[model samples]
Target: MITILNSDKNEVQKLGDLKPGDRAEIIGFEKAPVDFENFLHRLYEVGFLQGSILEVLQEAPYSRDPISIRIKEATYALRRAEANLIQVKLCE
Candidate 1:
Protein backbone atom coordinates (compact mmCIF):
# COMPACT_ATOMS: atom_id res chain seq x y z
CA MET A 1 0.00 0.00 0.00
CA ILE A 2 1.05 3.62 -0.62
CA THR A 3 1.74 6.10 2.14
CA ILE A 4 3.04 9.63 2.70
CA LEU A 5 6.79 9.86 3.17
CA ASN A 6 9.67 12.33 3.36
CA SER A 7 13.20 11.70 2.14
CA ASP A 8 16.20 11.81 4.42
CA LYS A 9 18.04 15.11 4.46
CA ASN A 10 21.55 13.81 4.96
CA GLU A 11 23.64 11.12 3.27
CA VAL A 12 20.79 10.27 0.95
CA GLN A 13 21.22 9.57 -2.74
CA LYS A 14 18.78 8.72 -5.49
CA LEU A 15 18.94 5.06 -6.51
CA GLY A 16 19.91 6.03 -10.04
CA ASP A 17 23.09 7.51 -8.66
CA LEU A 18 24.36 4.24 -7.24
CA LYS A 19 27.20 2.45 -8.95
CA PRO A 20 27.26 -1.33 -9.26
CA GLY A 21 27.93 -3.07 -5.92
CA ASP A 22 26.99 -0.03 -3.89
CA ARG A 23 24.73 -0.57 -0.89
CA ALA A 24 22.10 1.65 0.60
CA GLU A 25 19.05 1.68 2.80
CA ILE A 26 15.69 2.85 1.58
CA ILE A 27 15.07 6.06 3.46
CA GLY A 28 11.92 7.31 1.85
CA PHE A 29 10.56 9.14 -1.19
CA GLU A 30 11.48 12.50 -2.57
CA LYS A 31 8.66 14.93 -2.06
CA ALA A 32 6.43 14.90 -5.10
CA PRO A 33 3.97 17.41 -6.42
CA VAL A 34 0.36 16.36 -5.99
CA ASP A 35 0.13 15.30 -9.60
CA PHE A 36 3.26 13.14 -9.34
CA GLU A 37 2.32 11.40 -6.11
CA ASN A 38 0.96 8.34 -7.85
CA PHE A 39 4.31 7.64 -9.41
CA LEU A 40 5.98 7.54 -6.01
CA HIS A 41 3.20 5.30 -4.73
CA ARG A 42 3.93 2.75 -7.40
CA LEU A 43 7.63 2.80 -6.61
CA TYR A 44 6.90 2.26 -2.94
CA GLU A 45 4.84 -0.82 -3.70
CA VAL A 46 7.74 -2.28 -5.68
CA GLY A 47 9.83 -2.86 -2.52
CA PHE A 48 11.38 0.56 -2.11
CA LEU A 49 9.46 1.00 1.09
CA GLN A 50 11.11 2.56 4.16
CA GLY A 51 13.97 0.76 5.92
CA SER A 52 14.53 -1.86 3.23
CA ILE A 53 18.16 -2.65 2.54
CA LEU A 54 19.22 -2.69 -1.06
CA GLU A 55 22.29 -3.19 -3.17
CA VAL A 56 23.11 -2.06 -6.68
CA LEU A 57 23.60 -5.40 -8.36
CA GLN A 58 24.27 -4.19 -11.87
CA GLU A 59 23.79 -1.42 -14.41
CA ALA A 60 23.02 -1.77 -18.05
CA PRO A 61 26.21 -1.82 -20.11
CA TYR A 62 24.81 0.62 -22.63
CA SER A 63 22.39 3.47 -21.85
CA ARG A 64 22.07 2.41 -18.20
CA ASP A 65 18.36 3.14 -18.17
CA PRO A 66 17.24 0.08 -16.26
CA ILE A 67 19.24 -0.70 -13.13
CA SER A 68 19.14 -3.88 -11.09
CA ILE A 69 18.68 -3.75 -7.33
CA ARG A 70 18.47 -6.56 -4.79
CA ILE A 71 16.32 -6.39 -1.73
CA LYS A 72 16.42 -9.44 0.49
CA GLU A 73 15.97 -12.41 -1.85
CA ALA A 74 14.28 -10.64 -4.76
CA THR A 75 15.77 -8.58 -7.50
CA TYR A 76 14.00 -5.61 -9.01
CA ALA A 77 14.79 -3.79 -12.22
CA LEU A 78 13.83 -0.14 -12.26
CA ARG A 79 14.07 2.61 -14.82
CA ARG A 80 16.34 5.48 -13.92
CA ALA A 81 13.41 7.86 -13.77
CA GLU A 82 11.60 5.56 -11.37
CA ALA A 83 14.71 5.01 -9.26
CA ASN A 84 15.18 8.74 -8.91
CA LEU A 85 12.07 9.00 -6.80
CA ILE A 86 13.44 6.76 -4.05
CA GLN A 87 15.88 8.18 -1.49
CA VAL A 88 18.65 5.97 -0.07
CA LYS A 89 21.62 6.36 2.25
CA LEU A 90 24.81 5.13 0.67
CA CYS A 91 26.76 2.71 2.80
CA GLU A 92 30.51 2.68 3.10
Candidate 2:
Protein backbone atom coordinates (compact mmCIF):
# COMPACT_ATOMS: atom_id res chain seq x y z
CA MET A 1 0.00 0.00 0.00
CA ILE A 2 1.13 3.54 -0.70
CA THR A 3 1.84 5.69 2.31
CA ILE A 4 2.44 9.44 2.17
CA LEU A 5 1.49 11.68 5.03
CA ASN A 6 -0.13 14.97 4.23
CA SER A 7 -0.41 18.19 6.19
CA ASP A 8 -3.12 18.26 8.92
CA LYS A 9 -2.68 14.54 9.42
CA ASN A 10 -5.45 13.57 7.04
CA GLU A 11 -5.46 9.89 6.33
CA VAL A 12 -4.57 8.99 2.81
CA GLN A 13 -7.36 7.12 1.08
CA LYS A 14 -8.03 5.31 -2.15
CA LEU A 15 -9.22 7.57 -4.92
CA GLY A 16 -12.03 5.15 -5.70
CA ASP A 17 -13.75 6.06 -2.45
CA LEU A 18 -14.29 9.66 -3.42
CA LYS A 19 -17.81 10.64 -4.34
CA PRO A 20 -18.94 13.15 -6.92
CA GLY A 21 -17.75 16.72 -6.16
CA ASP A 22 -15.04 15.53 -3.82
CA ARG A 23 -11.57 16.91 -4.45
CA ALA A 24 -8.23 15.44 -3.51
CA GLU A 25 -4.53 15.58 -4.15
CA ILE A 26 -2.74 12.62 -5.64
CA ILE A 27 -0.23 11.31 -3.13
CA GLY A 28 1.11 7.98 -4.37
CA PHE A 29 0.30 4.59 -5.84
CA GLU A 30 -0.34 1.23 -4.21
CA LYS A 31 1.08 -2.08 -5.40
CA ALA A 32 -0.21 -2.68 -8.88
CA PRO A 33 -0.39 -5.43 -11.46
CA VAL A 34 2.63 -7.22 -12.90
CA ASP A 35 3.03 -4.59 -15.62
CA PHE A 36 3.21 -1.88 -12.99
CA GLU A 37 5.63 0.23 -14.95
CA ASN A 38 3.27 0.35 -17.88
CA PHE A 39 0.33 1.15 -15.65
CA LEU A 40 2.20 3.93 -13.91
CA HIS A 41 3.30 5.30 -17.26
CA ARG A 42 -0.27 5.46 -18.49
CA LEU A 43 -1.44 7.14 -15.30
CA TYR A 44 1.33 9.69 -15.48
CA GLU A 45 0.52 10.38 -19.11
CA VAL A 46 -3.02 11.22 -18.02
CA GLY A 47 -1.79 13.57 -15.24
CA PHE A 48 -2.15 11.24 -12.23
CA LEU A 49 1.04 12.55 -10.68
CA GLN A 50 1.79 13.27 -7.05
CA GLY A 51 0.41 16.62 -5.87
CA SER A 52 -2.03 16.94 -8.79
CA ILE A 53 -5.48 17.97 -7.64
CA LEU A 54 -8.49 16.18 -9.04
CA GLU A 55 -12.22 16.43 -8.62
CA VAL A 56 -14.71 13.61 -8.85
CA LEU A 57 -17.22 14.45 -11.54
CA GLN A 58 -19.48 11.44 -11.72
CA GLU A 59 -19.90 7.70 -11.35
CA ALA A 60 -22.14 4.90 -12.50
CA PRO A 61 -25.17 4.98 -10.22
CA TYR A 62 -25.60 1.23 -9.91
CA SER A 63 -22.13 -0.26 -9.99
CA ARG A 64 -19.94 2.79 -9.39
CA ASP A 65 -17.26 0.89 -11.26
CA PRO A 66 -16.44 3.58 -13.76
CA ILE A 67 -15.79 6.98 -12.17
CA SER A 68 -15.19 10.23 -13.97
CA ILE A 69 -12.62 12.61 -12.53
CA ARG A 70 -11.38 15.98 -13.66
CA ILE A 71 -7.67 16.70 -13.55
CA LYS A 72 -5.82 19.62 -15.05
CA GLU A 73 -8.77 20.73 -17.11
CA ALA A 74 -9.43 17.30 -18.55
CA THR A 75 -11.86 14.62 -17.48
CA TYR A 76 -11.29 10.88 -17.73
CA ALA A 77 -13.22 7.76 -16.82
CA LEU A 78 -11.42 5.24 -14.65
CA ARG A 79 -12.46 1.88 -13.32
CA ARG A 80 -12.81 1.55 -9.54
CA ALA A 81 -10.12 -1.13 -9.51
CA GLU A 82 -7.77 1.22 -11.34
CA ALA A 83 -8.65 4.12 -9.05
CA ASN A 84 -8.06 1.99 -5.98
CA LEU A 85 -4.37 2.00 -6.83
CA ILE A 86 -4.17 5.74 -6.35
CA GLN A 87 -3.71 7.21 -2.88
CA VAL A 88 -4.97 10.70 -2.21
CA LYS A 89 -5.48 13.28 0.52
CA LEU A 90 -8.87 14.89 0.62
CA CYS A 91 -8.95 18.61 -0.04
CA GLU A 92 -10.96 20.90 2.16
Candidate 3:
Protein backbone atom coordinates (compact mmCIF):
# COMPACT_ATOMS: atom_id res chain seq x y z
CA MET A 1 0.00 0.00 0.00
CA ILE A 2 1.22 3.54 -0.95
CA THR A 3 0.25 6.57 1.06
CA ILE A 4 -0.03 9.78 -0.93
CA LEU A 5 -0.38 13.22 0.59
CA ASN A 6 -2.24 15.46 -1.82
CA SER A 7 -3.61 18.89 -1.06
CA ASP A 8 -3.44 18.29 2.68
CA LYS A 9 -5.36 15.05 2.27
CA ASN A 10 -4.10 11.50 2.21
CA GLU A 11 -4.82 9.10 -0.65
CA VAL A 12 -3.57 5.59 -0.20
CA GLN A 13 -3.21 3.43 -3.30
CA LYS A 14 -0.85 1.27 -5.26
CA LEU A 15 0.69 2.29 -8.59
CA GLY A 16 -1.42 -0.32 -10.37
CA ASP A 17 -4.55 1.66 -9.59
CA LEU A 18 -3.61 4.68 -11.69
CA LYS A 19 -5.33 5.06 -15.04
CA PRO A 20 -4.13 6.68 -18.19
CA GLY A 21 -3.97 10.50 -18.02
CA ASP A 22 -3.47 10.55 -14.26
CA ARG A 23 -0.56 12.61 -12.97
CA ALA A 24 1.58 11.67 -10.00
CA GLU A 25 5.02 11.98 -8.44
CA ILE A 26 7.23 9.23 -7.19
CA ILE A 27 7.43 9.10 -3.39
CA GLY A 28 9.40 5.97 -2.59
CA PHE A 29 8.78 2.24 -2.31
CA GLU A 30 6.90 -0.40 -0.31
CA LYS A 31 9.44 -3.05 0.61
CA ALA A 32 7.47 -6.16 1.57
CA PRO A 33 4.97 -6.54 -1.28
CA VAL A 34 7.31 -5.84 -4.13
CA ASP A 35 8.52 -8.42 -6.67
CA PHE A 36 11.48 -9.36 -4.51
CA GLU A 37 13.33 -8.14 -1.43
CA ASN A 38 15.94 -6.05 -3.25
CA PHE A 39 13.96 -4.70 -6.22
CA LEU A 40 14.31 -1.10 -5.12
CA HIS A 41 17.74 -0.69 -6.66
CA ARG A 42 16.53 -1.94 -10.03
CA LEU A 43 13.51 0.37 -9.95
CA TYR A 44 15.74 3.37 -9.29
CA GLU A 45 17.91 2.33 -12.18
CA VAL A 46 14.88 2.36 -14.48
CA GLY A 47 14.04 5.98 -13.59
CA PHE A 48 11.82 5.28 -10.60
CA LEU A 49 13.84 7.80 -8.63
CA GLN A 50 12.21 9.95 -5.98
CA GLY A 51 10.58 13.33 -6.75
CA SER A 52 10.18 12.46 -10.41
CA ILE A 53 6.86 13.52 -11.85
CA LEU A 54 5.28 10.86 -14.02
CA GLU A 55 2.28 10.87 -16.31
CA VAL A 56 0.37 7.79 -17.29
CA LEU A 57 0.23 7.65 -21.05
CA GLN A 58 -1.43 4.36 -21.86
CA GLU A 59 -2.31 0.89 -20.70
CA ALA A 60 -3.09 -2.43 -22.22
CA PRO A 61 -6.86 -2.34 -22.07
CA TYR A 62 -7.54 -6.05 -22.04
CA SER A 63 -4.74 -7.18 -19.80
CA ARG A 64 -4.00 -3.95 -17.95
CA ASP A 65 -0.65 -5.41 -17.15
CA PRO A 66 1.92 -3.38 -19.03
CA ILE A 67 1.20 0.31 -18.55
CA SER A 68 3.08 3.03 -20.34
CA ILE A 69 4.28 5.97 -18.28
CA ARG A 70 6.20 9.05 -19.21
CA ILE A 71 8.95 10.22 -16.87
CA LYS A 72 11.42 13.02 -17.48
CA GLU A 73 11.92 12.87 -21.27
CA ALA A 74 11.54 9.16 -21.69
CA THR A 75 8.82 6.56 -21.85
CA TYR A 76 8.70 3.00 -20.59
CA ALA A 77 6.28 0.15 -20.12
CA LEU A 78 5.98 -1.34 -16.66
CA ARG A 79 4.08 -4.37 -15.48
CA ARG A 80 1.48 -3.99 -12.76
CA ALA A 81 3.58 -6.14 -10.45
CA GLU A 82 6.63 -4.02 -11.11
CA ALA A 83 4.71 -0.77 -10.72
CA ASN A 84 3.26 -1.77 -7.38
CA LEU A 85 6.55 -1.06 -5.68
CA ILE A 86 6.33 2.65 -6.44
CA GLN A 87 4.60 5.02 -4.06
CA VAL A 88 3.11 8.16 -5.61
CA LYS A 89 1.25 11.32 -4.72
CA LEU A 90 -1.62 12.02 -7.09
CA CYS A 91 -2.16 15.55 -8.31
CA GLU A 92 -5.49 17.22 -7.82
Candidate 4:
Protein backbone atom coordinates (compact mmCIF):
# COMPACT_ATOMS: atom_id res chain seq x y z
CA MET A 1 0.00 0.00 0.00
CA ILE A 2 1.13 3.49 -0.74
CA THR A 3 1.37 5.77 2.26
CA ILE A 4 0.50 9.39 1.56
CA LEU A 5 2.85 11.77 3.28
CA ASN A 6 1.89 15.40 3.74
CA SER A 7 4.48 17.84 2.47
CA ASP A 8 6.06 19.60 5.41
CA LYS A 9 6.84 23.27 4.97
CA ASN A 10 10.43 22.58 5.99
CA GLU A 11 10.85 19.96 3.27
CA VAL A 12 10.17 22.27 0.35
CA GLN A 13 12.87 22.20 -2.30
CA LYS A 14 13.44 23.42 -5.82
CA LEU A 15 12.12 21.09 -8.46
CA GLY A 16 15.11 21.92 -10.65
CA ASP A 17 17.46 20.17 -8.23
CA LEU A 18 15.89 16.81 -8.95
CA LYS A 19 18.04 14.54 -11.11
CA PRO A 20 16.91 13.76 -14.59
CA GLY A 21 15.08 10.41 -14.97
CA ASP A 22 14.23 10.34 -11.29
CA ARG A 23 10.57 9.62 -10.64
CA ALA A 24 8.34 11.19 -7.99
CA GLU A 25 4.74 10.97 -6.95
CA ILE A 26 2.80 14.19 -6.42
CA ILE A 27 1.31 14.60 -2.96
CA GLY A 28 0.10 18.18 -2.38
CA PHE A 29 0.38 21.77 -3.46
CA GLU A 30 1.96 24.86 -1.95
CA LYS A 31 2.07 28.58 -2.69
CA ALA A 32 -1.17 28.33 -4.56
CA PRO A 33 -2.82 31.52 -5.70
CA VAL A 34 -6.22 32.80 -4.69
CA ASP A 35 -7.72 31.22 -7.78
CA PHE A 36 -6.44 27.86 -6.71
CA GLU A 37 -9.16 25.82 -8.35
CA ASN A 38 -8.49 27.25 -11.78
CA PHE A 39 -4.75 26.95 -11.37
CA LEU A 40 -5.00 23.35 -10.21
CA HIS A 41 -7.33 22.43 -13.08
CA ARG A 42 -4.86 23.79 -15.57
CA LEU A 43 -2.08 21.79 -13.97
CA TYR A 44 -4.19 18.67 -14.12
CA GLU A 45 -4.73 19.23 -17.82
CA VAL A 46 -0.94 19.33 -18.17
CA GLY A 47 -0.55 16.08 -16.23
CA PHE A 48 0.35 17.34 -12.74
CA LEU A 49 -2.57 15.51 -11.19
CA GLN A 50 -2.25 13.90 -7.78
CA GLY A 51 -0.63 10.44 -7.69
CA SER A 52 0.85 11.01 -11.15
CA ILE A 53 4.47 10.08 -11.73
CA LEU A 54 6.77 12.88 -12.87
CA GLU A 55 10.27 12.83 -14.30
CA VAL A 56 12.51 15.87 -14.19
CA LEU A 57 14.22 16.58 -17.48
CA GLN A 58 16.07 19.89 -17.21
CA GLU A 59 16.08 23.29 -15.55
CA ALA A 60 16.96 26.61 -17.04
CA PRO A 61 19.89 28.59 -15.70
CA TYR A 62 19.22 31.34 -13.15
CA SER A 63 15.57 30.44 -12.89
CA ARG A 64 13.41 27.48 -12.02
CA ASP A 65 10.43 29.21 -13.64
CA PRO A 66 10.28 27.01 -16.66
CA ILE A 67 10.88 23.39 -15.74
CA SER A 68 10.79 20.57 -18.27
CA ILE A 69 9.08 17.50 -16.97
CA ARG A 70 7.90 14.17 -18.32
CA ILE A 71 4.63 12.69 -17.23
CA LYS A 72 2.89 9.63 -18.57
CA GLU A 73 5.52 9.37 -21.32
CA ALA A 74 4.85 12.94 -22.47
CA THR A 75 6.93 16.02 -21.78
CA TYR A 76 5.81 19.55 -20.92
CA ALA A 77 7.23 22.87 -19.81
CA LEU A 78 5.59 24.40 -16.77
CA ARG A 79 5.92 27.90 -15.37
CA ARG A 80 6.92 28.63 -11.77
CA ALA A 81 3.35 29.48 -10.78
CA GLU A 82 2.26 25.99 -11.65
CA ALA A 83 5.46 24.25 -10.58
CA ASN A 84 5.27 25.77 -7.14
CA LEU A 85 1.87 24.21 -6.55
CA ILE A 86 3.19 20.74 -7.17
CA GLN A 87 4.49 18.77 -4.19
CA VAL A 88 6.19 15.42 -4.71
CA LYS A 89 7.96 12.63 -2.90
CA LEU A 90 11.17 11.14 -4.30
CA CYS A 91 10.64 7.65 -5.59
CA GLU A 92 12.99 4.95 -4.36
Q: Estimated TM-score per prediction?
A: 0.73, 0.83, 0.75, 0.64
Candidate with top lDDT is: 2
lDDT of 2 by residue, 1-92 (tens): 99776564387989998889889999999988887778778889989999999999999889977999999999999887789899999997
Go through the candidates in order and give each one's C-alpha lDDT.
Answer: 0.81, 0.89, 0.78, 0.71
Error at 71, model 2, angstroms? 0.5
Cα deviation of 53 in candidate 4 (Å)?
Answer: 0.5
Model 2 residue 83 CA deviation (Å) reads: 0.4
**Candidate 2: segments with Cα more than 4 A from true spot:** 1-9
Which prediction has more favorable TM-score, 1 or 4?
1
As a whole number from 0 to 100, the lDDT of residue 62 in candidate 3 is: 95
List of clashing residue pairs for candidate 1: none
Kindly list the per-residue Cα lDDT of model 4 for residues 1-92, writing each as its tens digit: 99767554336454544656667788776766687878678778877777888888876677745768998888888765567667777766
Candidate 4 local distance difference test against the native: 0.71
Query: Which segments of model 3 are wrong by more than 4 Å?
Result: 1-9, 32-39
Q: After superposition, how far is residue 31 of candidate 2 from its true place, in Å?
A: 1.9
lDDT of 3 by residue, 1-92 (tens): 99675553247556767889988888777775544656667667768788888888999989987999998778888887778878888866
Q: How many pairs of residues collide in each model?
A: 0, 0, 0, 0
- Please give me the total number of clashing residue pairs in predicted model 4: 0
Candidate 2 worst ten-residue window by lDDT: 3-12
